[model samples]
Target: MGTSINDHVDRRTFLKYGGAASISAIFAGCTDNQSTDETTNESGTDSPDSTESDGGSTSNGDDEATEFNYVTTVTPSSIDPMKGSDNLETLLLHNVYDPLLYYTDGTPPELQSWLATNYSVSDDGQTYTFELRSDATFHNGDQVTASDVKYSVQRMMDMQNGFSWMWEGVLSPENVEVVDEKTVRMTTNDVYAPFLYTLPFLYIVNQDQVEANANSDGQFGEHGDYGTEWLEANDAGSGPYQLASRERKREIVLEKNDDWWREFPHGQDGYEVVSAEMVQESATAAGRMREGAEMADQWLPLQTYNDLANEDGVRVHAKATFNPFYVYMHTQREPLDDVHVRRAISYAFDYDAALTDVMSGDSDHLQGPLPGAMWSHTDDLETYGQDLEQAQAELEQSEYTASDIDLEYTYVSGLTVEQNMGLLLQSNIQELGGSLSVNKAPWSNITEMTTSKESTPDMLAVYLSFSYADPDTFLYPAWHSNSHGSWTSASWYQNDEVDDLLTEARRTVSQEDRVPIYEQAQRIIAEDAPALFVMNQATRNALSTDVQGFKDNGITGYRQTFHRYYQG
Candidate 1:
């Protein structure tokens, strides 16, 4: 899918083309001559003065431009804030929806009040009281009140889909109480340490607008569909942007909300519109960027980063992130049910070669699910490195012989890096007298298959980023037995000891006390070998040189502030 003219270039040709001379030659006569007056501040930050112009002049000198472009590989299935599990959807939803608390990206991540003006927690830590801002209003100009917050939480639980697990044991409908128009109180069954951090995922929606657009034939038919059908292409929250138009998997357009409650950090006259198109292929996205296509602002892929590193008017930003990629082994399936078989497959993987040759040395091989930056991570666990003799030995101990089974490996289609990793895995397994059949599908189809235990493949390669900074973000949904049928737990591997450890760890408030409990859980899970640790991914984005105010949060990776971006 990524095939292009650049794909046929050899290693020597790539290096030659990536030089400064080649870059200058490629854009000699096509460079824009108009100069911008905006300059960086004393602290070396891209902070333009208020008197600066709205948009920069292009080669054609058009002065009325008010739109910014973005490109992505996958299209969002639904814009419903409560029904999405991917990062791309989160980026789009954050622009049109406001959560109770907002996580700001910085040296140390902090949660700031957004819809909620203030909040308090009881000494026992089971009850939380929040004060809503009186000035906050939805897109329809409806005042946001305590009742809207209560209804939004209840609606999410009633739908019984998408991120409901975030509040599974912490909250319920009966525990929510509206004290007044601007005050609300919520009580939990026990002391959940991650409760405050998890509030960022609970987006507040206008109850009146949702109820008026409700349909009876939706996923949740009993509650008049809870506006599930209408929210797919619409927005009802109070944020900086509102939905303008959408064509499902093709493109989405957003217009600035002039009456937004918060002022733009840069200025009031930032880009008036933002549009994102689904390119699906890395080569096509890169080609568009080089040709100065109006729809090309960002591109994804390491190969694209290499190809465009020296191009004029292009910048590449890379940073270590909390996301980790792994190959999940479906323990509920036949041959994978044997722990020996899973361990053997894990040992046969050449992680170093995959990171160097396939990934272009842009990623770090992970020790376990938790990244080293997290507090609870440890280096005490055993890692399964490439050892063909050890792999063969483990295979001999399994119930079935090497020829007894043919493993089915699946990965996201249109991703060249993933396809290469899958092929490398097949070769490694073949060396140990095992067979692997590689399969590929679109991300949307793979996500659908992961919802059911029977539909999940024997092995699937996927990437996961933390929803919160705590260790529970990596442990609870992944290793807990209750998450068996969910897409987060495609491995379908469960252990009672690991479940009890994770449950206790979440309730433990003191970081000192929780460390040992999480360490014990990580050790146990590593010994069980439910999934093979692949690599810790780095957030990489190729953008036009004029793009500014794009900060990558170590905790939330791609959650960016669109209102802060100005072309000049």
Candidate 2:
């Protein structure tokens, strides 16, 4: 055993060269679901018809009284799984991919084993071993093994080739152990309470595909470069779906793993997937969802959220995913370096006012790092508000007068949600005392600003998903100095107290006991105002009325197959 305790859409390092960008290209883009006589003879099944759904549909429950299979897709900026950072990974990707263990359908720690039939840890918490599901098979029809598990995770631990740092300090390569081809073990340098929750997101890609481009000269194929060349643009998951195609912003397709051996929805019985596909960031994904062109869908962003929230025909399913929106002052830089000035700015604008007047009250005011959905959420915590007198007084306390306090904010454009947010903030600051400028840049440019050391903007609005539901979601990665260790720590905040609070929280096992500590940590980060922790909104989703059986599925696992699909 080693040590213990570690842990989305998040990263876009892989740059695919070409692909189609139309919604119509869907279904047609799904290339190979055919059971050729060769493999079909081995597996003993006829070719699954792409046009007809397994016409044998059923209403599994009250919510399932409709006609269709499950319809969901993980929407990561990239599906490599190792670089996962956004709603896509936690909400969707894990469904199609498997790690050692995962949250059983409705229970938090039912810890139903997937690729791994069972797992165990040493008494010292130094090492962990997982027994692979002997019957498991990858999308490529390859056997699942311990090497694939070690290779996939270790690659993330190797930073030069992978941004394993995104896992923060939870994963340490010094701890991984391979116990033969069927058993794998992991040891941690420290105790980690959220270990199981973190594993589901670490999808196991096939070792062979990872080494597809290895140099014939013998130096490039090994897992040693730390997964550098292997996972660049590969897929090896043994789940309900497999990578059918990926054409950068065009479309990504996942033909169902007909050989998938998992039990049916709710584990009642077993079933085979006919086919499943995920539309990419291309213009098509949105079009299909907006036009109601299909029964299955994935990755609907702001527009989809708004449309379905109000539309009558679409059955929108939205839960506030783990993301916190915020605005920050660059303390390491100019004017913002002064606390009084920062406080003055904080007081200058009223967030409640902004949410009401602009956000249509869809969002809430800033307080703690965790959202209302988190167990630690506390309206009782100290919060910021607009105070003309206090704001002016703070401004007066600082060297800058009204005219001297000139500030600029950078934001990503092309979204009404974004426009209203920035404009409201601009108005808030303008009414208080300082002169404020808002710059709306493209998503690419805005992302660049945060990652660069020399060019990080003085002030900007960023929405980050706290991937897992644990308090560490807000603590470790958001506040720890080590969090800033990676280029993604755009806030550049340094607080020892905050870091300690998070570290302590992660070490403890009781979630109930973890609340007070997290609450106090929230108070600390709020006062520091690394980013004015803004509001949390329900990440929205919608299904046609015919779509059922998925209504009550909380923020855990996603089953887009025939869990409750049937004819209404």
Please list the C-alpha lDDT of all candidates, in the order they appear.
Answer: 0.71, 0.54
- List, in order, the clash count of every candidate structure: 0, 36
* 291 Cα displacement, candidate 1 (Å): 4.0
TM-score for each of the candidates: 0.87, 0.74
Candidate 2: tens digits of C-alpha lDDT, residues 302-345: 44444443544554444433445667667666677777777777
Per-residue lDDT for 1-568 in model 1, tens only?
Answer: 1111210111100000000011112222222321212233433222432344433232123456467777777766678977876666777788888888766543334566778877888888788888888899999999999999999889978865666777887789789999999998889878887887778778889999998998877666666888878898888989888999988888888888877887665553466777887777767777766765332322254545655656777765554555577789999887889988888888899988877777656567778766666678878778889988888888899997778658988977666666777889999988878899999887678778888998998888877646765778777888898666666788998899998898888788887899999999988888889998887765555667766666554444233467666555
In model 1, the clashing pairs are: none
lDDT of 1: 0.71
lDDT of 1 at 61: 38
Candidate 2 error regions (>4 Å): 1-76, 89-92, 105-110, 160-167, 214-233, 264-287, 294-313, 318-323, 377-380, 399-408, 412-414, 441-449, 485-488, 510-516, 551-568
lDDT at 52 for candidate 2?
Answer: 39
Error of 2 at 146 (Å): 1.7
Each model's Cα RMSD: 9.5, 10.4
RMSD of 1: 9.5
